[model samples]
Target: MSESDLQDNNPLDPGDNSNLASGEGHSEDAPPFVPGLDGDPGSDQEEANNLEESTPVESDAFNAHVFEGQFEPNITSYQIIWQGSPNYWAGRGGNKIVAICDHIMQGSMESANSWFKNAASEVSAHFGVARDGRIYQWVRVENGAWTNGIMNRPDTSLPWLAEAIQKKINPNLLTIGIEHEGLTGQVFPEAQYQATLWLHRNLIQNYGIQPDRQHIIGHYQIDAVNRPGCPGTGFPWQRLLTDLGATQPKTTTLTSSSSSGGFLTGPVPGVVSGAFGPGTVNTNNAYVRSYPSFGAGVMVLRKLPAGTLLKFIAYTDQGAVYKGNSRWYLIDFTDKGGWIHSLMIS
Candidate 1:
């Protein structure tokens, strides 16, 4: 496949390259791989034997099989079906696979495999997860797949990410893409979620990646404008992050006396109380709900005008993402404490 084809066949957008641009202030040169522990020298061979033994005599619901082909770096314990088109290049010079990006196939596994395996598609990912939890490997972990398109512009919300984009380096060079079999907004099956969790854990352990949102990000976060709804908002981000032990502390103590009056007489049931911190409303007429989620049958206490300063006590994860914000903070408004969406506050 041609480079243009590879650049044009992103699953999120087939022909949008407005975000593609040459990076600045950094060499286009890839990094060098720093060899690390490969975990139990005999593990791969043993696993290969086990995999062969575990192969079913007949096809069943989980008709999983390994593709016994050569890997780019030739270092993976999992079964990989070589279905990648010859459109990718060697990964970041260091043979490094830093991030694990998730994507929705927007179709069944068959269609995903068909599209990625076809040379004309020019799009491919390192791994694919079927609805039945079957895992397929298309590209080698050490190679770059034309999965995540170039980020032509820097994401100001994540300044730390600018370095990678500024180098104009393809994220495929540093990340492994896992295409989950499904359509946008569809909840991932339990089997698929389990399989992905296993894959992610293995990848994290193998690559020494910090199990955090920064390292394991959804495609939507990477190219928010171009692919805002990718992997869908229904994706259980909190569950995945919690499983990876990446959740951060939500409580912060305040020293100012302005919040003392708002403190409740006793700890509220099901509510995590803490000292208040200063925050400002960023949106007009933001509602302060009695609960984190609007679906929780909680009452909307009041509305705070934009630019209203508030004291936040704690935060909760209600799996609600309003205007790109998933967190809700417990704040004091009108002398009554309520939960406010993070998007409405700076």
Candidate 2:
């Protein structure tokens, strides 16, 4: 669908968003989760230090993208500077920026489309217009997009996480930037929150990046040399790290798997055509989603590319029903549950 279609269907509408800031989205959407003790910042600090020390060595596998012009050249004019020895990649006085305009998702679907489109086109970053926990990707993660910037030189101590970023930024290249739907202060719905965390976890595991608070920074924390308070303080930074199992900062490499596997299986890959239905037969496709109506606690055990294998995690009556047939397979990935065509699975 085009960007307009996505905006028209923005999930931020009151009717679409039922879980605002309740931390119901992903297990990690909740805020201010104290992992150890309220005062034990030492352990956290040590962990952070260790992660930094163990930071992964940069690679040249990623391709960097050409950074577009400023977000609002005339309107935004901020300056950033760094402190301490030039050896460290840390800076001070920079904060995130928030747009006074209505939340990206609360406005017209067209607005959502434009916002994401503009973000992707105007800036070098991975942008998505997410609603009700569903996210639409506007940019690929393979290329280094200009999403993060240093207000000053010292905000970062290490060089780009990889060669792509090194040429452009000291660290932005290594980071996977994401934009969520909602106003600056508005709380994201539980479904959306869960989706964010799930997606984050998937990215972390897929990319093998260490899951940590340091690596996962909110837009608010970013400063444009002088501009500040972006993305607003409302972002649940702590909660996101906890839920995604990314607490340690400075970790360079992640050791986990992010693949969710296939939802449908067929004799050939990508052959599971048609919309999801009850007993419609599933062909191996990893993109299947289970309708949330079936409730939770359902899982799938299959691989992608069709003609692979089969296994069921937890069965539920949620998908593809025949003319009057009453058989469903519970499907739940990234949180928003849904049904699929049975015949599509095979």
Candidate 3:
């Protein structure tokens, strides 16, 4: 399906969401959760900070797209500044991103900048969207951040904990945490809301995640006794799904064989395919575009030849279809090495 097709699907429509207890994570759409334990987050705050040993961060001066990193932002449009934090696990241990958990800072962005940076704070969300709309990525999405699981090991087998207990993994391993500024009594900022909408859309799209409460959840869902009002009151839970259903991007797949006519030139001396791995290119040359889709106006990053050696870091299947393949691998050559279509490699 094309980008338009994704937008046309009402997958996230609030009307279609029914709160059915499926046990399996995101097997079906669920309705908005009504807050049950809304009170002072005082004790939970202490418990959360007391248990896990930490993780946010600072931004650089340069606004360059060509970054010095191993992974690139899935949502490329926003002004996302990489604020490296030290309090996170190295990787997800092969676990895919299953949920995007929303959280409330309950404090100012400046406080988050200081606390998330402090190792003693022992808490860090993957991404933080400020009230002013500045997006900060404290931890890479591929890693297990000390966001929700930093709290005391949840020993309770409450019905709400069905997903994590059943999966037999730390909640952090299965979810991406997003901390939004403000709390229950305050009105959620529209600017922050818009920024989060795009962030959620891009994040869920990358994993083909269902845009529902089961996947796009609040922190309260993880540990209700502690953070029952997380991402707090006034947050537009239903509207988030409705808006995403209408505006999410759709990657259309076109079936054809060897339609990469533009890549017919001879192989270059040291260029090759490494999006998925060191798979030698079978074609003459493959174009590394800035993003996934191939189009007239898309920016081509490199023209790699068949003989060039290659290696890869990660991949995403959300890319546009080419020769019946929608898979693209992320090469670690540089932040701008971009993506190579899977078919280009042998």
- Which prediction has the highest TM-score against the true structure? 1
Query: How close to the true structure is residue 43 of candidate 3, measured as C-alpha lDDT?
Result: 43
Model 1 lDDT per residue over 94-212, tens place: 54666788877666777666665544445667788887878777655666666776452223233335556666455667788888877666788888888787677667766676777
* TM-score of each candidate structure, all chains considered together: 0.55, 0.36, 0.48
lDDT over C-alpha atoms for residue 269 of model 3 = 19
Report model 1's TM-score to 2 decimal places: 0.55
User: Model-by-model lDDT, in order?
Assistant: 0.55, 0.33, 0.54
Candidate 3 per-residue C-alpha lDDT over 94-173 given as tens digits, one digit per residue, 9 for 90 to 100: 66677788877766666675666555545677888888888877666766677774222232222334555666666776
**Looking at model 2, which ten-residue stretch has the lowest summed lDDT?**
79-88
In model 2, which runs have C-alpha deviations exceeding 4 angstroms?
Answer: 1-112, 115-121, 149-154, 157-171, 224-227, 248-346
For each candidate, C-alpha RMSD in Å? Answer: 12.6, 20.1, 18.4
- Measured with C-alpha atoms, the lDDT of residue 344 in candidate 1 is 54
lDDT of 2 at 288: 42
